[model samples]
Target: MAMEEKTPVTLGHRSRTLTAEEIEKLSDDKETVSDFKQRKLEEEAKKHWDKFYMRNETRFFKDRHWTTREFEELLGQDFELPSKATGDQPTLLEVGCGVGNMIVPLIEEGSAFRFLACDFSPRAVALLKENPMFSKGSHRAFVCDMTTSQLLEEVPRESVDIVTMIFMLSAISPEKMPTVINNVFSVLRPGGMVLFRDYGLYDQAQLRFKRGHKLRENFYARQDGTRAFYFSEEVVKSLFESAGFQTKENSYVTRSTINRKEGIDVPRIFVQSKFVKPQARYLMQFADGV
Candidate 1:
């Protein structure tokens, strides 16, 4: 079979900085909310996300080749290929794969891999199914909520070779993050790897949260009412290690983007980590060429 060539799409620039009015509104929006009020606000936010994707579908985020560039840098050149297996393509699962932002690029690259993408939002999953870039013959996309559902029931236990969580975890509630991690671990094959990337502590988003927008410590509400939690390296490491995976690479990546008008530089911290599942006895025997 001839491999298909892929052209990378560049996502055009968007300013991360908010205007004065936006910032002021953020500060004033939730000034007197109580804990019960905050929970209500969060429920409303979830509805907003559902409506947002339902209307815009997969176009909410610009289509770009983010997965290949970012995952390669984090895991090295051979990261996308299957290890310890011959004559079989690796199987991958993407949790919170909204509109095939990463999955489309992976398929276009013509790698020897198969994928299963899951998202909690039905709109997102429907959009994924309609995407031309996805091959229904070999790829699967479905709606599954990792925090509360049994991942193994939907995705086979110990069958996935790579799992991706790019910009996905922080969108989940902080209290439910561990449950998501454990669910991901359940579906991952022995010796499989996990690639993760998300917003880090003290990023611009964190500093921009209004006084009453704090849902819990470190979690913030956006103008659209969507909430996100900024993570620290220590918190991420503890979460994964506690879930029985070894952190092979963990680092804080800082990137500076310029405000072309003001000539000011803004730094964003992104925490990236790669974790590996310990091979079960049967898989270790296979790696040893038994």
Candidate 2:
């Protein structure tokens, strides 16, 4: 008898139901940690990220290739940056921008736009500045901890045209996720948008965590001391909405990568969304008259 060849599913396009065992293991009921401990860990968020950058420098994650493809808004079609009387352009702030992976490509590919990219890790910001693509005219790199810091102080309130939180918010504790969302909301212009993508709940990497590494609910600490959180589409939507954002697109993207030599498959899931700070009611009314 001959074995039948199976068709392969491309990564991030296929989704599967969680097994009973997986559901049971991923349940939050089993998690038991004191609020004090959780708070302590959350406070140390910056220390861990700083250490990660000090250790990996610019080699940790590969530059993301999917930002523009997934976000046509980044292409500058919906709204054009008014040609500046002084050559100034619309602004974008990339929270948790590590080593300029996503923004570098955006700068290299898109029309000229001002950028304010920051991270909790000073080393990451340093590396980003060192990149040949980094420019003082269009890009500025800073260090900020989204959990406790404020974006309004750094970027003018209601001035930023877009905030890209790509895989960055999950590093924040669930307790501070609201603060992060609110900060994004504050910096964005009345009609500005947030382009977001982060690990989705039940992704293979989440299920692959070793026993005892789980920190709380969907959050986990890796062997390197850096932490991550998996998110559900609904949870993310609520977070942004609660912060006064109007959700435009919210959905999960699942892809699988098969390793033939190892006879293994890895499924990656991401929740990608577009949310806008509602144009101020006055602006809405005025636009209606226009």
Per-residue accuracy of model 2 over 68-132 as CA lDDT, tens digit each:
78888788776543332235477888999999999888877754677799988888998999987
**Which pairs of residues collide in model 2?**
11-255, 11-256, 12-254, 12-255, 12-256, 13-254, 13-255
The per-residue C-alpha lDDT of model 1 at residue 126 equals 83
Going through the candidates in the order shown, the clash numbers are: 0, 7
Candidate 1 at 73: error in angstroms? Answer: 8.7
Assess candidate 2 and give its TM-score to the true structure. 0.84
Model 2: CA > 4 A from native? 1-15, 27-29, 33-39, 79-88, 281-290
What shift in Å separates residue 240 of candidate 2 from its native position after superposition?
A: 0.6
Report the lDDT tens digits of candidate 1 across residue range 1-290: 99998864332113244455655555455544577867776566547667779878766687657667767722336654444465465788889888888888767777556789998777888888898879544899988878776577788787888999988898887888999999988888778889998998766667666576677766877776677888878899999988989898877777887999999887787788999887753323355555
> Number of the top candidate by TM-score?
2
Residue 29, model 1: lDDT of 55
TM-score of each prediction: 0.79, 0.84
* Cα displacement (Å) at residue 57, model 2: 1.2
